[model samples]
Target chain A: MNLLFAAEEAEEGGSGLVSPVIGVMLWTLIVFGITLIVLWKVAFPRIAEALDKRQRMIEESIDTAEKTKREADELLREYRERLSDARGQADDIVARARRTADAHEQESQAEARTKREEMMDQTRRDIEAETRRAIQQIRSEVADLTVLATEKVTRKSLDSSDQKRLVDEALAELDFAALANEERR
Target chain B: MSQSRKILLGAGGAYLLLVVLAFILFGSAGRQDFVPQEEFELPTWIELGPLDINKAVLYLLISGILTCVTMVYIAKRMEAKPNRIQTAVEVLYGVMRDNITRGNMNDKMAAKWFPFIGALFLFIWFNNLIGFIPLPTGHHHFTVLGLEIPTFGIYAATANVSVPLVLSLLVFFSYTFEGIRAKGVGGYLKSLIPAGVTGAMAGFIFVLELLSNIMRIVSLSVRLFANMLAGHLIILFMAGGLAILLGIAGIGVFLLPIGIALYLFEVGLVATLQAFIFATLSAIYIGGAVAESH
Candidate 1:
């Protein structure tokens, strides 16, 4: 405690280090009080208000940005959905057109086959009729040639009953049915 | 060519210049005092009733005026997109409001006390920062061209015990009043003890707590006062005080660089740090007073 005593003595001996000066203290209080009051009344409130306003502005901006982003996202989703629907409709239309085309092709092919068969039938019937006429002409020519040869061999004109008899014999000997069969083959 | 070599050469050159200057100024002078305690003594420049206008009061007035004007001006001109000075002011405001005041107390209490705490921080910080700057407030004077001019020296009003003492006293009373206001006198005293302690042990603890409470003023004041005073003294001694005292001014050549470094350190960190600590402690005291437990 001797040290404390020495320090106290030093303090008493006009040491400005620890000694309290009333005027300075009073002045400190006065100055500090005035500063506090001035700052409180004028400076601090404005600063606080500005800070609050800035904060609110920032929050509002953030909210607006978020809302816009959400709307854009929604629009994008809707557009994608519509595009997908359009694509699906296009696919269905193509599929239906393909089906119609397939049906039309089948019908046209069947009609062509039927027309071709009827034309082939008509062509075959025409050939058969022409062959029959030609065969009849050949038979009549054979009969007439046979009659003329008989007259020439006999060296005299035969009577009607004789010619008839000769012609009947010649016709009986001829195979007209076989000739027509050969023409058909 | 190497970085270290370059730095060494630069230091050597500076040291040589300082030695030459020191020798030219004080080579023939005898021993001188490093600690001139009288420098702390303020002489009245003006007297009005009980008030003696002096350098300490002058510094306080300047600090107060600057605090008020700078804040009010910045507050008036604030914008959403801040410029450089506005950004700096905003950063300081955030530090005072968020770190010091609101860090320790509830929002209500913080709002109520933010102005006092902010002013305290600004006032103390300005005083501490200006203390490192050499001003024509020295007790000594030199006559140049038949006119007396005060010498330029560094002094801080915070280094004066009375200034911090008064501020600390205010803090002490404010917190004490808050405690009593929050709880009745008896309840506030009872709350000083820890929650579990009872009987005589609780009484002993309460007395100890009360004493600790009282010591806040000394701790708060002395902490600020001693730090500032010590920083200034170190700068003074290292700059030339020791060389002057030892009758070898040439040694200041080596000490001046260290003095410069310490000067930067004090101005850069200690000034702001001390103010922050003072305001933070004030907040904590006030916050603790209103809290349910000690």
Candidate 2:
């Protein structure tokens, strides 16, 4: 007890101030010192740590959220780009298929027309050759019939070498190549 | 709050009824010891061993226990988010740390002295508040079979000069130690004399500064002790006067309204304000001590 707490003396006749008791001060110091130590060890440290941890957790969550948002945006952009690329490819394929079909149709038309013209030319040439051959055969048959009639009427034989010459001259008069050219013109 | 608290309140109500019955039976109590007289005079202590413990000491111990229990309970029940008591503790801690410690001192010294100053603030502040409340001790000597039974009660511990002296001495030693540690002993002594002065002027300034430095303990202790003691005395005087007048002329009832209001203001405002002043001043002292330049 300090002078004020010296109740014995102050109560005795003292109006103000009591004898300072050293023991009270010492005990108070001991008790207060224990309190201070406890505060240092427990109260202050715990509070400071809790506050710091909360702050850090908040900041980390904010950072993670931002990162996730950025990554999502990037993915969206990539998907849109791929979608456009696929559309363009589909258009190009359609155009290429149309061009191939048109070229094929034109080529087949030209080939069919050429085949018809070749068939007509072959039919005309065959007709010309048949007509010339029929003409030559008729001429030779007429020469032989006349010779037979002369022989029967006069009762005389014609010379063999002269008869062959006469048949050759008749075949010469019916030219097949000339007649076919004339018909073609 | 809790089921237990409801039960406790119920018990308290029953106890109050018992006290009322006892008061009625005893037929009014004595108010002689409740009055204040001398300026510095308070209560005395009962000597045990070499130490003299008083009513104030017991209350001081109770204040400490209250602080400990509250903090420990909060610590055990602490959550990711603060509950009521935890929030109260944090708010009080924040005020001391940011407002008082950081306000008077720079960042460097604020962190160091915050705990010490804060502890003193809470301890003194609560004790001062509890001091205003007079416990129900029945105020009667009950004799059962020729044995007198007494009750135990607590009051304002900070009003006692010894309590405040112990607190002041802690501040005194802490700052002085920090000052000496910061600047060497010789430099600290030299610092008492101002710069750019010599001879008589320097000596005069040195003596004044030294005296002022020594007076820090007295100012700190006396300021708290006086303020708390003054409030207690004033309330005691009011209570004693009311009791005396009521017993004599029954005129004391009229004073109840003003008396109750003033009492509330003193207990609530004065108690907290004094606590703040004590902590802030303590921080400022340590700040000055450890500062490279004052």
Standalone chain B TM-score for every prediction: 0.93, 0.77
DockQ of predicted candidate 1 = 0.55
Instruction: Quote the positional error of residue A9 for candidate 1 in Å.
Output: 8.7
Best by TM-score: 1
Question: Compared with the true structure, what per-residue lDDT tens digits does model 2 show for residues B1-294?
Answer: 999999999987876665456556543544333223332333345777556564545666677777665665555565568778778877887898898888877787777788888788877777788777665322335676897763323246677677788788889889889889889997777776766778889888888988988899889888887888767655654543544523421223334445677688888799999888888888888888777654
Best by DockQ: 1
lDDT of each: 0.87, 0.70
The A-chain TM-scores of all the candidates are 0.79, 0.46
- Identify the CAPRI category of the predicted complex in candidate 1: medium
TM-score of chain A of 2: 0.46
- How far does residue B151 in candidate 1 sit from its true spot (Å)? 0.6
Model 2: pairs clashing at backbone N, Cα or C within 3 Å = A1-A24, A3-A18, A7-B44
Chain B only: TM-score of model 2: 0.77
Over A54-124, each residue of candidate 2 has an lDDT whose tens digit, in order, gives 67988999999999999999999999999999999999999999999999999999999998988888887
By summed lDDT, the worst window of 10 consecutive residues in model 2 chain B runs over B245-254
| TM match of model 2 to true structure | 0.63
